[model samples]
Each structure stands twice: as C-alpha cells, then as structure tokens.
Target chain A: MIGNAGDMNVVVCVKQIPDPANPGSLDANNNLDRSSKLIIDDSDMYGVEMALQLVHAAGSGEVSLVSMAPNGETAGLRTALAMGAEKAVLVSDDTLKGSDALGTAKVLAAAIKRIEGADLILAATESSDGYTGTTPVQVAEILGLPSVTFAKHIEVDGSTVKVQRQTEAGYDEVTCPLPALVTVTAGVVEPRYPSFKGIMAAKGKPLDQVTVADLGIDAAQVGGDGAGQKITNVTAAEARKAGEVVVDEGDAFQKIVAFLDQLKVI
Target chain B: MAKVWVLAESAGGKVSSLSLELLTKARELGDTVEAVAWGADTASIAGDLGAHGASTVHDLGDLGTSLPGVSVAAAIAAAIEAGTGPDILLVGQSYDGRDVAGRLSAKLDKPVLTNVVGLAAGEPPVASHAIFGGATIVEATFTGSAPFIYAVRPKSFAAEPSGGSATVAPLSVPETGATNAATVVDRHVEERSGPQLDEAAVVVSGGRGLGEAANYAMIEELAKLLKGAPGASRAIVDAGWVPYAYQVGQTGKTVKPTLYIAAGISGATQHMVGMKGSKNIIAINKDQEAPILQIADLGIVGDVHKVLPQLIEALKARS
Candidate 1:
C-alpha cells in the first residue's frame, strides 16, 4: 500500500518560530520567550508548499503536519493547514521545553511512526530561529529511513523520490525510494498565501494534539535535563566599530579604488 | 592526548577546502588527528590530508555513486562500535557533511553540535555557535560521552600545509541497505561565467537600491571588470531581481571574500551576517545610516547609479 504510485502520504515538519523581524528576548530559562506571538517560519513554508505540490501532482494523497511547540501552540500549524495541509499532529508538553535537536527529532520520529503509513517526510533545511539544520536527518535516522538534505527540487515516481540537492559548486541529482525523508531549502518553491477561503476552511481541519506520554517518550529523555549539549555561556558578539565614512564627492569612486588598491585585491 | 576524527570531503580525488580547514584545527585540539574519506581510491589525496596535519587516513572504498550519507554514517558507526572511533568527530557544515552528522547522531544516540564557528580546547572541548543573525555567540559543551560530532561551518578556520605525511588505511565498506537507497542519477551544474561566490577573492553585490532589474547589469559589469564574482542581497533576490544562487545573506550563502563591495545595498542584519567576515568592505549606498556602512572599511555615501558607472569607466580607462 505504501508503494502505490498515486497514494503518497507526506508529513511536513513545521515550527512556530518567533518573528525574526522582531527582536526577541530570552526568558529566565534561557529559551526564546514563547509568550510572544509566533508565526509559521518562512523556511518551513517552503516544505509545506513543496509537500502540497507533490501531493497534488500525485492526484491522490494527503499532506499532514508534525510540529512540537510549547504551550500547545496551534497558531503556526493553523497557517500550514490553511495552506492546504489536510491534518496536523502537534506534540506539545510543558516538559518538552528546551528539548535540543536530538530530543525534538526523537519526538517527531515517534509521532511520524504512529501515522499509520507515511510515504515521505518533508522538512525545511533549518529553522530561522535555531538554525541547527540537523533535525530532519536525525528524525530519518531514528526512523531508519533514507534521507536527503538541501533539496532544491523533488520528483516522486513509482516507489522512488528524486531530488536536486544543492551544493557549494552547483547541485547533485539524488534519488531515494519511498518512505524516505527530504529537507527542502528555502526559495525552492514559492509558497502561496492563505486565501480567505482556505483560511476559513482551515478552521475545521483536524489538529490532533498529543503529549510525550502518548508518544511513549520518556519525560526524562527530553527537555533540558536530557539534552546532551548545554550552553555554558552566552555573550554578545563584538560589534563592528564605525569605519571611515566619506560623503560622495566626485572623487568618491577614486577613493574606493585607492582603498581596493591598498588591499591589493584588484 | 585525545584522538580527533575529521571527515575529509573529497570530490574527484580533490580534498574539499572545508575538510582541510577542519583537519588543521583538529590538530590543535587532539594529540592525534585522523581523516576519513569515502571513495574507491583515496590514496591520491592522502598526502593532501597529511599536509593538513592528519596522521592517518581511513579510506572507505567504493561506496557507489550515491550521496554517501547513509553508507558513510553506517561505516563510521560500526567503527565506533568496534572501539576504533576518535574521541571527537568533526564534520564540515556542507550539505553532505550535515547529512552524515545527523544520521550518525541518531544512530549513535549522541547529539551533534552544528553551526559551530569556533572551538576551544578543554576537557570536553567547547564549541562556539553564532546565533541571532550573528549577533550573539553561545559556547556549548558535550556532557554525555566521547565521539561527539560537530558540524563546523566553512571558513571558520584557516587551512595550512604542515609538510607531513600520513599512513593511508582501508576501511571496509558496508553493504548498501534500505537507508542507502538514495542515488544520484543526474546533475546539472549552474553555468557560472565567473569565479564561485564562496571562493572568489573579490565580490561585488547589489541590493534593492538598484531601482530596476536592469540596473543590475551595471553591477555585473563592475564585478566582471574587477575580476570578481557577482552577489545579491536578500531584498533583490526576493524581489525577483536575481536567482537564489546569487543571494548573499544569513539565509543565503556565507562569504568571506578578501574584498566585498556592496552597491546600493542598505545593509540589514540578515545580509550583514553572510558577508561580515569579509576582510575588507566597501559600501556604496545613498543612505549613510545603512547598517552595512558601520562595518565597511570604506563607506561611500553616494548613489550606486552615479558611483558604479564612473568606477567602471575609471577601471576600464586604467586597463
């Protein structure tokens, strides 16, 4: 059933990240303030949009969302639902606070495993806030599935999924079988804004709420207590000191050249 | 004396610059530094790895034409299980490096420290991460066990040759399994007319201040005249003025060129993070208060339209 070409069930990992445009403060726990209004991360939108397109192309499929946010935040998940995700499974628990990348991957992997038959899992390469860029592949490892990262383009045919993985020099063409995981890069696809009708329709979509206990994740194995890596110190980066500023005299271009010449870069 | 492992990423028998950078840094943090490469014959690059301070090279022969994430991670995990792993494993922050690090983290049940820009030698070896659009630095250390994996960003450390030789050893390649199902069938290299953005010594970038898309041609012309690469800001890329590959910002490619010229770009924090590491910055913007001007070694408060053409003409006349 999972190998059926037309029946592609994709699970997209989304996050409710703090608005990056707004300066966010750290709470006493050293975590980003969750009380502030959160929105669906721009990076995650690429994955959501890619999943929607892939499922649409297959003609018969469903796109579900998996997210782990504190205080059972559905604000971000609702946005993805409005963008056309059929359903969502949000794992929210107070004890899950400060769960690092590995812990988050464990929870997401367990939730995905319980989703009956998921053919593909899609995620953003990294979150705008944390930017760890390792969670999706970690989830793939936990689930014992093949995974690809930095996918700029993806195509699913029969039991195989192919991708154009971005690289420093250019890109590499990669193909993986069904039940694989792929992390999409931002700008890979243009995400559509939620139309008024889609927004209204999203209100009725099923957003299943789960807890660590439901997923059988040991409470001690997650959160700050279980994190293998701990931040020992946080310091502001040395601010760049103001440099020489010159008003655009007619010779401003000449000054720039002299400076470049001084650096021997020309 | 700790043992350190650096994942040497090689393509077509050439060692990646990032791997060499990690090997150079690994030599300082451990008593012994070994590099692991995946290919049919890694002997050709063994000297290059040794020159970067690797005492030994483990070559995983012929892992097929796949992405190498699954097979490499599986082989490394098996080696660790057999007590042949190093105390710490450092991987580059490239696409394939991150894949291997993630899979290894889950397979070994150990968390990976990623986006690390600096490392301090200590009992557990603290890793420094640049966060909040490069505004803050956070120092973290592993608490649980050895063989802690870290994905270090490119250009974090300088690579230098030590004129040393290392012994090359063959590592048994593991059989491809279900997790190794991904394979590369085709590749399309973006036809680049100039030096690669990340490796270019000089980079000339434009932003929304260019007004119209056609104005970007002047930027390309100036970059070409300067023998540099052309780059774009997130604003221009988002405005559909350029492709995503040309973007230079926090969400885009990180560049540390020797000289970075920003034309008509009002430096936002997002854009600054990507090129702030550049050794010399020259910002040409009409707005004097652009955040980029603060970091520019030479800030020109002028319109790019006025400055770029004259500069191009001057360069052309000089040549």
Candidate 2:
C-alpha cells in the first residue's frame, strides 16, 4: 500500500472544548459556565480516525497530533497520542488564550508549519462548543493549502483524493491532490478507541511544549495581538419561555367540537 | 479611501446568492465596494460586481476554477500585495469563505474574522459575531494591516441593488497558475421544491411538540401552505419524528429568516442559535411558560397540533 513505509505524514488538528451535546445552562455573558473538565470534540476524533485509516491503508505513514489547548489541555493531547498518533505537539502560551475561531486557526497553522512537514491535514467540520463550523476553512486558508470542507466521504488513492461534500440540499463529489486539507463532517466515520497498549505506550511519548515564541511568533500573532480579531464584549443568549396549552377532554363528539372552538383548530 | 471587497463563489460560471449579500454588506461599509470574481466567467465580473456596488472588478481571465482557499486567496492576496485590494474583505460565512478568509489573512498578515455578522471599518475593523452557539454576541475589532477578512453571517444583510457600470479588467494570477488546487469535475446542489431554505422569509419548525412521526404531516402541511422550508428541532429528529438532516441546533445548520415559527419547542440554548437571527419568532406551545417563547416575537399559548392545522388552513384560504 502507498502508506506502507513512511510514504506520507498525517496531521490532525484537534481542540479541547466543553461538551455541548450534553445539556447545560450558561452563565451571564454567554460563556460555557461548566465544571472545569474538558474533552476532545467528536468532530476532531472523526478527523483523527480518518487520518488513521489513511495511514493504515497506505501502510507506511505516521499520524501526528497538533493542538492549541494550554497546559490544562495536556490530558486531551495525551489521549490523541494514545489513539495512535506517533507524537504530540502542544502549542500553548498565556498569549494564546481566549482565541476565537480565526485566532485558533492561526495558531494551528503556525504550529503545523513549525513542527512536521505534513502531506495531509484534517480537522472536524466544526467544534461542538463554539459551533462556528468555520475553523477547517480558516485553517486551510492560513496554511495556504487547498481545502475540501464538510466532507462526508473521503477516498485517497496514491497522490489524489476523492471527497464527497455534504450540503444543505445534497452531497457533492470533488477531487484534490495530496498536500491538501479536509474537514470531516459528523456521521462520516466513528473513531476507534485507544487500545490498552496504545494508552500505556502514549505515556512515554513526547508531548513537546511550544509557546508563542518557539516558532519565532509574536504575542500579537498568537491571539491577543494584531493577527486576531478580539472580542470586546459578550452578551448572553436570550432564552424562550413556555406557552399555554388548550385541551378538550370530553366525550368523542363533544371533544372535537370543544377542541375546535378553543384551539381554533376547525 | 476605504473599500470593501467581496470574494464571490460561482456555480456553472455565475455568482452565488451569498456572494451577492457579501457585496451588498461591503457596500454598506465603504464608499467604494469591489466585487472580485475569478473562475470560468471573468468577463461578467465587472457587471455582476458593479451591480452590487463594485467600483472596480478585476477579472482574472479563464482561471481554470477557484478552489476553496488556494486559488481564491492567491488571486485576492496578489492584488492586495500589489496594492489593488480593498480596505475590508467580506465573504459569506460558509466553508469556502472560511478558507479564503484564513488564507488571505495569513498571506497578507492581517486579521480575519469568521462568522461575523456586522462590520464597521474605521481606524480598525470591528465585527460583531456569535460565540458559544449564539448564547453570546461577541463584538470584535481587528487591529492590523489593510484588507482584513470577514466571513459574514447569512441573512444579516438583505442583498440590495447597486447601480454602476462593471469595468472589466484582464487580471492575472501570480506565478501560481490560473488554477489553484482541487479540480471540479462535477458539482451537485440539493434540489429544493419550494423557496430556498436560507431565503425563506417564513419558516415553520417542528420540535418535541410534534409528538410523533404520524403527526409531522401537519407541520409539512403548514410549511407547504406558507411556501417555506421546514426546520426540525433535535428533539423531533432524536425521537424519529424526522430525518437528522432537518434538525436545527448548534451542531446542525445556522439560519436566519424574516419570520420563524417554532411549534412544540422548549427553546434549548443550542436550538436558539440556529433561528435567533430571525426578525420575528412565534412560538406555539401548550405550556404557557415553555422556554421557546422567550425569544419569540409573538408567543401563542396553545397546542401546536391544533394551532398549526388551523394556521395552514388560514394561509391556504388567503392564497
């Protein structure tokens, strides 16, 4: 297979976010006021799975995990390493905090450029938390790579790839060469779990510590500076209240008439 | 001299609706708005762009086709690099837009705001965007060089008309060939039976209030009568009331229309972001205090199963 012996390098960019699939309430100013535990979003996991499949299929490639989460997110990167990534690179710094979608993409692209010379990169269609659905595109743009976003199906044959795009109305099929990028959509493929041995071996893997300075990057380039679009204010989402219910609980004939009269259902 | 630029996407060699809106919003921000089109139809760039208030349209000729981010950014950045780019770049907040905005910002070393709703360009570009699934509206301003990229949210700007002559120019792509990356052998668009989902001024969505599958016909009847596309809450889909494709929530699609009517909905935070952009929301639930009514412009306290049928009948009668 094409991947049999270090034929290509795969890079998966993942983010650590609070789970939104589980219902929860938000605090004032609209931040995820959750308990301080985080996990990798499912979208990123699917991305990792796709890369793993490609590497496994070609038989000669390695998968590398790259993330923008701070030291607090080390646990999540370690999990990626356990999931079969050969190594982990953590792009963390005080300067890289509070990043929105664009800022995060900038950080990932800069980090990707500095670490490994990658032939392919993948990410989730969108994060479950911010739900911007814009990161993949932004990341591609930042890296100056050709991108295929919202892909429901992806097939790589040697140097070229065939992608099935998910649209509101239907799906589209597109083809692109290697050294390209893709954002996998939900329901594309389920990511496998890290085996016990994989988990054990991951503890010995290098979780490289990189900051805004390691890549000759300035604080401004990280998140808070000129390269980012900073948020000045945050407003809570307005909630909705319940409405009145009208019922008719009489006999069949009378119930129809009453229900019609009360609900104007007639 | 402030100028706003719209990078348009094309289908079968014509511009897209979102591109039109991008140019319209850009026109709102600057004295001179430029619509840049690169693809099969370079000749029509000036005319289409001028119609949307583009004072200058650079037509990079017969450029095989613009890929998501590569070709689009190369053409746009080369212009900016050579000093023909606009003060602000407005793109539709879709996959293509994100790609272009990200690459353009990196190449130009400027700030790019994704999923931005509003823009104010002065000493710097301030853009209003949604965060935390529309729970918080974040106001952002970029302090960087010229040609800041913005992926504008949908329906934020009513695509208005601009009258001007499209002055076509035979522009050229940088050392990079006319084509960037990715080949477009075929493009498939989902067929809509009624008004387009994003364009529908009125949308009647189904929720847990829908009850079961057999009951969804009533909701469809209402949507068909109103000539609108139906939106489904995750509850209904999760409950097998409809397909997951119809679901509207944080993980699903984000849309805005003129009037949104959610029935049997409890108004979860994730669900609200998808429709909160609507100009008016009307919620009909049996529970008078159901969560869906908070953002509703008009809250109708009643059973949706009953109210919906009658409303459909009323709409049909009016028609």
TM-score of chain A of each: 0.93, 0.82
TM-scores, one per candidate: 0.94, 0.79
Best by TM-score: 1
Q: Score each candidate by Cα lDDT.
A: 0.87, 0.69
Least lDDT summed over 10 consecutive residues: which range in candidate 2 chain B?
Answer: B171-180
**Model 2 lDDT at residue A264:** 37
Candidate 1: which stretches are off by over 4 Å?
Answer: A1-5, A245-255, A261-266, B211-213, B234-245, B250-252, B264-270, B285-289, B300-306
- Residue pairs with backbone atoms closer than 3 Å in model 1 (clashes): none
Per model, the share of native interface contacts recovered reads 0.82, 0.47
lDDT string for model 1 (A18-51, tens) is 8877766667877767778788988899899999
Clashes of each: 0, 28
